[model samples]
Structure formats: structure tokens, C-alpha cells
Target: MALGREYFEPSDGERAFAETGRSGRSRAVQLLLIAEQLSRRDGDELPTGLREDAEALGTPELRRDGSDALRGEQRARAVAGTRLRSYDAGLASELWSAARAESDPGAAIDLLGLSLEDPSPYARLSAILGLLSLAPPDGSTSGVDGYLLARLFDEQYRAPNATGGLARDLFDLLNGPPGGDVPRIGAVPPAPLGSGPLSIGVHGTFSRYGTSRVAPSHKFYGYLGEEFSPDLFPDETRFFRWSGRYSRHDRSKGARDLPLWLHSVGGVGELDTVYAHSHGGNVALSAAADGVRINFLVLLSVPPIERSLAEWAAIKQNVGYAMSLRSKLDWVILSDLVAGRTRGARDLLAAERSAGLDFPPEADVHTTAPLGWFSHSSWLDKRVWQSTTIEAEVRNKYLLTHPGSP
Candidate 1:
């Protein structure tokens, strides 16, 4: 059977656009709603009254702001042409300008081809939206459009921070019927016998190094078992790690499964902490939103949050404490910018200073002192594992939970 009606409810702006033909909403919101409408054939076609609205946006609307006005006009033309099923004479020039400005000339050319040569602008727009929905983070065909697409999928579609309306509808549409498209990440196989208080590491991006190689296990476990003695961790402080292959892979799937993975490997109700790096940090954040419990959360070069800071703070409080170690490394900046997630990252770090009653007391965010050497990949170095900072943090957290013994 098809999905239920509850899956698709138009937002107020969408309703306004449908009724009055104009909502004056942010162009991003308008574009998203239009894309969602164009994707489905099950609904009625655009009604008669929307023709003027479509036409209004069909041609560029230039104003005093100039460049800003031009950009808005470009987006509006695409939206209008999509809605009205046609474009004005000047579309070829505009499309060429947009293409030349694009970093991915090939993808831009393809888009231009579809926008100009396709008989139906609606179909062309739908294709653009679909590509945006399915676009990978980097590699082939990646640039501004790809970045924007990935960000849209992460921030607007998958994240809990998403406000409902047409965005939600589009997410539901592509997500498929419940239990259909999304794979059920099976529980982690049981840990070995006598698994004690655990220190789990979640790695970002699958590599030849393989899954579950959080740290050189020998370093952490060896220190606990041989160097530090058994009393602190009991049975050598169980070490576990997990990684979802390839950073490009959709994270929501692995994210949904992480809590269960934690439960399986560490045992539900097992007290422990997790150190997640890069996109692994994103997965940890997702698990936290699902109410996963841990003694502490240590994130290294975590990306930005997809939801509101208040919501993130509330989620963070579920753990004993959250310690974020951020770097001003150019790699993270360029990568996040290219990934179209710089805004989310900025918002997440800014939450540290957010004044209000809603902020959680347990949050402890740590940015590197200016010019700190840590990079997004810094955690991979064995030196970081041996560093006193990490050792102190882990030792302190253990002491806080256990209290009496050193």
C-alpha cells in the first residue's frame, strides 16, 4: 500500500503559495517546496491561479541591490520556469552565465542542457531537485550545487532540527514506506566475555584500515591492562570501535544504529564514554538525540549541528558531560565550506556562548588555543593517543564516575 496521508502535509508557506500564488518567503524555502511539488505525480497539477506567480518569477526581477538582486532573479527564473512549464527568451543567456560561474562545468553544462533543451521545465526542475537529494559529498560532479544538495539533505531532510512542511513531505517521499528504503542496522554482535567499563571509538570514513579501528587498540588497552594495571578499568577496560564505511555514505543509517551498537558491544546500561572523530561525531550527536547514555562524549573536530543549539544542549545533557575539541585547521574550514556545512558548524560552536535558561550545564566545549596544531585528521596520529590532554580527560572522567580509587 502507498504511504498514509500523514506523511505529506504542506507547510504554511506552501499553503500560502498554493492559495495566494506568492508567499514572499525565503527563496530557499520556496525552491524546496516547488521541488517537492514537482517530484510527485500523485497530486493534482498546479491550479489555474498560480500562473501569475509562476510568471512573476519566470523572468529576472532586478532591483537596487544589483548582485543580490541578480542572484535572486536567477533562482526565481528557475523556480518560475519549473512551475509554469516554460521559460522566457533570455533563459539561455542566464543559464550560460550561471554555468560559467559554476566550478563543475560538466555538471553545469548538463543542467544547462536540461534547462534549455528539455520540453518541460517542471521535469528539469524535478531532476535538479532529485540530484540535490541524492548528491554525494565530494568527488565527481561536486561543487557549489553538490554542496548545497548535500547540505539540504543533511540539514533540512534528515536532521531532527527540520521544521515541518514541504521539506518534511519531500523527506518522507524519498524515505519510502516505513521499513522499506532504510536498512535496519542489525545489533552489534556481543562483546567478548567479562567486557568491563568500555572506551569506544567511532571512526569517520571507511578506509583500508577497516571498521572498528578507533585507536590503535594496543595503545589504549595495553596501557590500561599492562601499564596502569587492571583495577581502574577492570578486565582491562574493554575497548571497542565502529566505523560506517565511506564518509560519503548517508550517515542517518549508521547514526540510527549506533545506540544499538553501543548497547550490543558495551551492554545496555553499561557505563562508558565514546570518542568520535569527524563525521563520527555527527553519528554520536544523532545517537545522543535518541537518548543514548554515556559517561562522556569526546568529539574531535566535530562538524556542525543540523538542529538548533538549544536542542543540542538538551541532548548533550543526557551524557555526564560533552567535551568538544575543535581546531581552526584550514582543512576543516575548506572541507566544511565545500560541503556546504560551514554555517551549521559555526552555529554549533556559537552555542557555547548562547545565553539563556535552556543551555545544559554538563556541556564543556574546548576549542584549541589559537594556532593549535590539531587538524581534522589529527586524531589519527598515535601521538594524540599518548598525549597527556587525552589521558587526563579520560582519567578525570573515570575518577568522577568511580570517585574513590586513583
Candidate 2:
């Protein structure tokens, strides 16, 4: 579901829903919360109210308003309580025991993994908290591991929009404040700049995909720099990887400030071209729309952006040229469409036949373009850049536009 929708925002329906303590995901979340409360203190017994809640949950029927709960409520309640007890006796107990006994990072990770995949949603949610408590500096996982866990949580739990859970809350813990655990890992510190026209490479998500050492965004930038080298001096073009906001909340505060960062980094009107992939395209588009002058904008396999063509036209007006390199075979777009986060999927799919009204009349759109063969992740692959047709297009569109370029 569109992560943009404010699930936690207050409303009458939400207030009423909270009172039940038995709403779908909400009930699961409560159980997790209670488990977290109990798990933190080494010797504390489960709270009386929480214990009763768990037992009552195990029992059966009721709409908190004294009306009959939804069908299957009793069954769900039983499942939640049973799962809670499993943690209380089995894996959760082992985790606490291991922690108190001595440092056993490996064991903790193993148990946490089991909890994460537990049959109960409540167990999964609570396991995340347990995992966080054991994270780096104090626990086994590194900063990179922490970041990956955060992404995993978002992808598995947040993406589904099940019961409007606490994905956002989890994100803050990782990325928030100085010394934040997740932000400390897999983070790409900004590269120092050089004096001259620059080829800024804007990266997409999965910043911490493999190891902390191999950042995909930075690697893509290096490849582009290698490709663009002969056309300009090494110092003339530089790559900048933009990961908007620490969290993925729509139009997050980080996104709001991106234009400022862009202007600050390259100086307004100084950047010669912008090469963006995936969600980074959104950041580039928003920056251009907000007044950063971009000469050439190349968007690769990004979802549909901009609410209207007029908005895109404004971006086009400021850029000397704009191109969208997309692939019809990339199931990533289809998956995003199903998830409801990307409208660009529609625009990209339509671009397969023609520009299909997603882009301005003058914009060049390439569908199933060889730039990225058949996958969303292929943009970083060398084979895509090796395509003769793709190489020729880049030369004509980008290098040819600049007098000194190859």
C-alpha cells in the first residue's frame, strides 16, 4: 500500500478501533508491544493487564464494545496468545537466558531469525524489537546488518500495509538522531567535490544490499565515471548518491530538504547532468521542479513521477534534454504497482507502446531499452552499458551536447 498514506494519523475510526484491542493487525501489534515491555527487563514478570489480555485473547469472542467481535476473532486471539506463550517459554526465553549468561551474538541472531519468521504476526513484530536491542555496539549485528534488518522489516511488514503496523516507528529507531544505529551503517558519506561541470549519479534504494563495503550507488557512479572519463577530465565530473530521508515516509522531511542539498552541493545551475535510477528519480525530479537547473536528466527504470505532464514540462523546460530508459520485462515495476507505491509503473508500462501521455510531448522515452536488459536491478550491470545501441544513444544525447565530451 502507498506508504504515503498516514496510517498512524489520528481519526475517529482509529480511536474507536484502538479500544477493541482485538482489531486485526492492531491486536497483533499490541501483543508485540507487551512482549517487548516484558522482554526488556531481565526478571520482570509479564504485566498483570498484559497477562490477562493474553489469556483473554486465548479465550474467545468479543467486540470490545460488548458486541460480537468479527468472525474468526476467537481463532485469531487464540493464535496470538499461543504464539506469545511460545516466545515466553521457548525462543524468547532462550534469548534472554543467553544474554544474561554471557554474550552469544550467534545464538541471539539465530533465535531472532526464528522469531522474525514465527507464525504469529505478533511474534514477528516483537522479534524485531528484540533484534534491535541486540544490534551493533551492544550486540552482534553491525551497523550494516542493522540497516539491512530495517530494510527487511520495511519490505516484509511495511510494504504490505497489513493492519497499518509500526514500520515507520521502526525506521525512526534506525535512522533518527546522531549515533542512530541504522544510519551508522551502510551509509554513503558525501564525496568531496571538484571544480567543474559534474555528472551527478543519483542512486536508488537497497543502499546496503550486500556488504557495507560495496555500496551499489557508489559503484554505479564509478562505472558511469569510467564511461564518461574520456569525454571530460577526471576532476570535471563527480558522482553524488542521494538517499532521500532516513526513512521511507512519503515526502519525508529529508525529501523536503533534498533541493537544498542539491543546490548546496553543486551550486544552483552548475550541474551539467543528472543520472538517476529508481526512487532517486523522484528526488531528481523534485529538485528540478523546485528550481535546480539541470542540463540533461536521464531517468532509469524509475516509477512514474509528477502528478501531471505540466509539472514534468516545467522540469523539461529547465533541462536541455530528458530521457527515460525503462524495461517492459522488469517485474519490479509490476510489483510496485501491486504495492501501490509507484504511479510511474503505469507511465512506464504505457511507454512500452509509445510515450503514452506520461511524459511531456518532447521528452524521449525508451521502453524495454537495452540500457537495462530484463531486470530492474540490471542498471548496475556492465552488460547494459555495453549495448551498442544504448552506448550510441548516450553518446548522442549526453556527450554530443557538451562541446568537450567524446
Candidate 3:
């Protein structure tokens, strides 16, 4: 390995990473491995510093991936993916308990997202409860899913969906019978949009959880995570006490985003990914046409909050800021209005007007693409509201079908 490293080969690093991933790997060994993997990229030679770290068996991977962005990302994903598998297989829970009780809560947080997927209900519930024990999301104690699931799973209770009208069967499973006691843990899941007449699909901030700055690696999946819970309210508190189209519908847990008939959409690999997505939805973003007003918009990732989005609020204060203008070209979206192929929410309204149709003023519909952006921005394009249905029959069916539901 030393000779290979001296020769500056990428395979040496790969081999080192694969070996250190095993259970007995030391903190130093694993850390070096993580760093090496993270700093890697296609056709690129591994850095000597990392190679030296590998040979030293120095420490566990530290902080987040960075500096050498691609490699950093690689390492983070590798570590996350490996731990994720272990947790998925039900090993991490046993180790987590030992680690957490021994004053290594930080490690516990590292493993929390993976822990949520554990097979043992206790293991999963225990992990959830453990997260709640820490600084809950915003320190609110009200809508704790750990306690809620623990209690619901224990007491046979279910939160009714205020919009869907029908409740999910998973309700009783979560709300029923007391499982053994598990300490609460975890950050609170963000609140569901509140149960108000205007809340359903209501256009608002696209970045709800601050997506950009929030490290994607940190959002790793865990047993019974906040990700599974829907915040009916925007504040990231107050559970809606009801499920809706947002959560899995038992009828079609295998399918996603009903578009009437779409088995013929080409691209076998993409189709398989959509069909196989655990969440039953496509995981990648897709669109048609180019320029300011694209034909259709389908954001595979839910419109999430990014670090850069906080500025949108500030920009929107008067018109020159980055925030989305409602319509009629506030200074922020003027380019989109004139270019007709701009970014930001107002572009959506422009798209609508182009179609010679306007939504009722009360509907409050809007778009969220940014116009004329620098190449360096973290979240260049989060969502562009532009899906179209030429068929009058299909459009009416969607709005009318969800009549009682939000």
C-alpha cells in the first residue's frame, strides 16, 4: 500500500477505504478512510496527506466533508452508506446504546438517522425517544413523534387527517399498545402546514427546512425519523393529527405521483428508480423546455428549505431582494417577466398568463424560481411550478377528486 501510495495511484486509496470500513477498524483507521474516500473523484489521484493519514490509522472522520468538495462528499456518503447498511441490518442499535450510555452522545447523533430504520421497534422507538431527549427541533415538546409513536404504538391512538378525511391504518399500529420504555431522542420534525382552508398546496416558501446550508449528509435516514412525520403547520411544530396525500396512501404505496397513465414514459433506469424508491416517489428532479418559463416542473425532492433561502424572505421585503414576487414583475422577477424565461415564483404566474388563463385572485397560486443567478450559488433552482395538462378533463378531475381532502 505504501509503495502504491508513493506511486500516486487512486486504487490504493480505494483499497484502504474498503478495508477500514469493517467493524474492528480503529477510529484512526476509519477516519483516515473516510477522509480519503471523501477527497476522491473520477480520474483524480488521492491526496498524499490523506494517504499518510490512512497509513497512520489516525482517527475517526472529523466534522463534515469539505475543502476538496467532491472527495469530501464521497467520504461522507461512503461512511453514511456503510453505517446505513449496518443500522438497516439492526446492528447499530446495540452499539448505540452502549456508546450513548458511555458519554458518547455525539456518536449517537451521527448514527441517529440510520437508527430510525432499525428492524426492532424498540430499537427504532428507542432511537426516536433518545433524539427527543436532546435539544428537540426548536425545543418544542408538543409534537414529539418519538413520544407520539411510542405512546401511539402503546395506546392505540391515531391522529386524524384534517384534510384527507380518511385516516391511515398505520395509525393504530403507531398509536397502539405500550412498547417497553424507551428514552425520547431527536430533533422535532418540522410542523405540517396548519389545517386552514388555504393551507393545502398553498404556494409559500419553497425552502421549508433550510435545505442549502443544512448538510445533506446530516439528513441521513434513521429509525422513525422526523422525515416520516408531516408538519401540517409551517412553524415546524403542531402535528396536524391527520395524514393526507403527503404521506403514503395504502392503496398505492408502490406507485407515485398519479399522472393517469404513464407506464410508457421511456428510460427504463429512471422508471425503475421511481418504482423502487422506498418513499414511492421519483427521487430526481425533471422538467421540459428551457428558459424562464419551462413547460412542466417536477421537483423529485420536496421543495425543501436551503440556507440561501433565508435571503428570499429579506429580498421579498420590497422588490429588489431575492424573495419571490407574487406576480406582475416585482423588481426581483422583472427579468423573468420580460425574458418570459426567468426564474422565481412570478415566472409561474407568467407561465399561467401565457396560457391565456388566470387563477382566481383568491387562489393565491405563485411560482419560486430565481432569475439571473451567479454560478456559485448553493441552491440555484429549487422548484419551478410549470406542470401542464392540455386536457380539460384531467385538470378538473384532480381538483374535484380531492374535494374533501387537502
Candidate 4:
């Protein structure tokens, strides 16, 4: 079915099933619900296997009662199925695991496509990552169905949000020529650092999919440079472009490469500050953990994944000063909690904190919610940059001060 439909409310039986602690049975119900939802969306009758499973599971609420009760039964069944498919965290985790484990590319593609409808942003993010993983190393889209490719593009245009933009870029990569492999550690040589304090911008994940110059994240970096460079930084502002892929492997490589690149330009001591958003922040922190001592670090909505806690903790020792700007309404980091459950413990302990991630005690934390900036990308907004509060923080407090003066 076309995505972005209103979420269905769960019935008493469905809620009871979830609370029963029968994980195996719950998964079966979830699959049945997903099958039913997909079948109905495709204008097809309910599949026999799903119907049989519903009967076997004794989930009468998920089966059509009778012809006379068609409307009510359909509603109940659909609601039950939608709840299991969309709202169940365990189910979402299972979907990701299944997509990763599936051997057949075609089956894996179908599973990933279904996962896009999940309410958890992590699941949707995983789906996009799975698609990229399935793409041919040679950059050919030969095995993928043309209709599915078109549908993905349609979803991208319809949503037009962060995840949508990511999907669009992935679509471009699938359709276009191979961009070649991700760079190795130290592959990118350091450019000349001009005479004054240097400020560097590193963009978040999915940014490397399309042209680096025109990406929204890149544009945001450009805006920051133009808006603040003249007064805040007398020297030069530059962007450090990395793979921007959503994987530990790529991020670890970036962490190593960032230090190598900076050292070539006279090390992090020469850097006045580094501004990074989302996973970009992780890269910077990971670099600090690897001994890149930074004068200042500004993190925008970086997720506190369990694997990155050590890097976050390292900031106190490796960074002279750190500032984190976050929005309370940033759902992307919440997705990290949901998706991280599959990996291990959830890193962010509290949901009420800035960006849902905990920062070191030495770090300065600010929430954009009071400024009416709620979206994950609100920090990138020109209005946020222009606000008096942010002006005081960035211009007067952080940037205007000498390096290491928090």
C-alpha cells in the first residue's frame, strides 16, 4: 500500500498478546499482520498461509468474522496487524535482523521495502542501509526490479524529510554509475591551513550518496561559514568530506582519517573548532578517542549509541571545550535507542535530555526547543543561526573567546 497512512490503533487482544511474553508466538502474529497489510494494500485477498496462521494462533480478532461483519472484522484485523507490524519494537528489530540475514537479494529487497513503513526511524534507516548493501559493487541496478526503484523515488518525493532525502540519494546511487569504493585511512591528503584559526565542518550520514557540494548538509555548512567566518573565524572555514556511510566500519575509518588529515595541516592544535552534525559528531568524538586533541568541538544532534559511549566519555580528556546543540523533538536519536536494542544496551539513558544523548559533565549543553526549533535539522536553519540566544552562545560565548576558553 502507499505508505504514510495513519497508524492503526491496537485492540485489547493484540495488547494482551504483546503482554503475554510469548515472543515466538508474538513474532508469528507480527508476520501475519505484515502479510495482511501488504496483501490489502496490493488489492489482493488475504493469503491462505496468513489466514491459517491467524487461525492456528487463535487470534480470531485478526480473521474476518463473517460477510455480515466484514467492515468491523476488517478494521479489527487491520488494526491488530498494523500494531504488530509498526508499533512493536521487537518486531521492528526482527525485521532488521531478517533483512540482514536473507540470502536472496530479491527477498531481502522486498523485506527492506516493507521495513520502510515502520514508525521507528531506525528501522527505516536500516531499510535504506540494507538497500545500499544490496547494491552491486560495480554500481549496477540490474537485478533490482524497475518498479520498486520507481516506488522508492515516489516515497522520497512524498516524504521529503531527512529519511526521504536519504532514500532519494540512495536511489540516485542505485541508478547512477558507481562512485567507487570508500576511501582508506589517510587516503585524503590535508590541504593548506590558512593564517588564522581554522574551523572545519563534517556532515552527517547519507550525505555522501549524492554530490557533496549540493547536499543539504553541505549547504548548511556553507551557510555557517558564510554567516560566521568574517567575524568569528578570521582564517578559513573548510568542510571535511568523508564516506558518510551509516556503519561502524566507515565511521572508524573516518575517525582515523580525520586525525591523519589534521596532523598533516599541523595537528588539532591549529584547529580553532570542529562543527559536526549527527554521525559527523560521532566521527569527531571517535577521532578524539584516537588522540586528536581538539580546542573546541560543537556537536549537533549526535546520537549516543552504546558503542560510542567511550568516545563521548573521552571528550573530557581530549577536548579543551565542547558544546552540544540539540532539539528535544529530534526523533532520529530515539530511533537509535530502538535500533540499538538489537545490538546491545541503549546508550541514551534519558529521553528528556537534549537530542536524547547524554554528554560529558564538562560539555556545555543547549536545547533549541526553547527557541522553537524542534526538528533534527533545526540547528541548520538560518533562523536558528540568527537568533539572539544562539548569537550570544556562538558569537559571544564560544567562537568569540580564545581557544580552550569554554
Per-prediction TM-score, please?
0.44, 0.44, 0.19, 0.49
How would you encode candidate 3's per-residue C-alpha lDDT over 151-211 as one tens digit per residue? 3244222222210111122233223342221222222122234422111011111122333
Q: lDDT scores for all predictions?
A: 0.40, 0.42, 0.24, 0.47
Q: Residue 11 CA error for candidate 3 (Å)?
A: 42
Highest lDDT model number: 4
In candidate 2, position 228 carries an lDDT of 53
**Candidates 3 and 4: which is better by lDDT?**
4
- Taking the tens digit of each residue's C-alpha lDDT, what string does model 1 give over 1-406? 2223312222232232233222212222223223322222234343222222333333121111224234334444433344455533244334433433442223232332334223332223233343343232232233544333443444343333212222333333333332211354533344446766655566664322433234434354344334322422332234333434323234556666665655654454433666677667666666665556666666665654335666566566656666665443223322232222222222223322211111123345443322222134544434454543665665666566556966
What TM-score does candidate 4 reach? 0.49
Give the range of the ten consecutive residues with the poorest summed lDDT in model 3: 285-294
Off by over 4 Å in 4: 1-80, 83-161, 164-195, 209-223, 230-238, 263-269, 307-313, 343-355, 360-370, 399-406
Check candidate 1 and list the clashing pairs. 206-246
- Evaluated against the true structure, the overall lDDT of model 2 is 0.42
Best by TM-score: 4
lDDT of 4 by residue, 217-292 (tens): 4565567667554322222233366788655556667877775666555543435567778888878877776666
Candidate 4 clash pair list: none
- Measured by C-alpha RMSD in angstroms, how accurate is candidate 4? 14.8
